[model samples]
Target: MHIELDLNQNDLEALLHHCQSFTPASGDSREDGRLADALQALTEALLEANASQ
Candidate 1:
């Protein structure tokens, strides 16, 4: 299944900020790495969404 989100520019920006500033607890390098990858994908999505408007 697919998902959809309806977020305004400010909401998207705030979400991006939170994702960029997130830091998982120490000793969880695997989860931290996954978060980093997700962040990268989210950032790209944010840019693409903005560009489409």
Candidate 2:
């Protein structure tokens, strides 16, 4: 599946903030680690994509 979003600068900033501040509600270390990793990846990708725009 493919998804696309059209976000303004402020919206991008807000989404980035959420990605940075996210904490998994589950106490499982493995699950939390995966979630954190995914968020980090997303943050990096978002920053890179934003910079390229």
Candidate 3:
């Protein structure tokens, strides 16, 4: 799924850089942990989408 990001220039740049530098940490929980950590951004996106409705 594609989610459009709503970030300011500096924040977006940082995010882009972070993704570029991101290498997965080892082991099973790593993926889920990352997703859990990322839920804030996803939640924000959902809120934005809902607000626009």
Count of steric clashes across candidates, in order:
0, 0, 0
Quote model 2's TM-score: 0.81
Worst 10 residues of 1 by lDDT: 1-10
lDDT of each model, Cα atoms only? 0.80, 0.90, 0.61
Candidate 3's C-alpha runs over 4 A off are 28-53
lDDT of 1 at 33: 86
lDDT of 2: 0.90
Positional deviation of residue 33's Cα in model 1 after best superposition, in angstroms = 0.4
Q: With candidate 3 superimposed using the best TM-score fit, by how many Å does residue 24's alpha carbon deviate from the native?
A: 0.3
The TM-score that candidate 3 achieves is: 0.42
User: Which segments of candidate 1 are over 4 A away from where they belong?
Assistant: none
Q: Once model 2 is optimally superposed onto the true structure by TM-score, how far is the C-alpha of residue 26 displaced, in angstroms?
A: 0.9
Q: Which candidate is the best by lDDT?
A: 2
Q: Which candidate number maximizes TM-score?
A: 2
lDDT of 2 at 19: 99
Ranking by TM-score: 2, 1, 3
Q: Give one digit per residue, the lDDT tens place, for model 2 in 1-53.
A: 34577889999999999999989879899999999998998898889889999
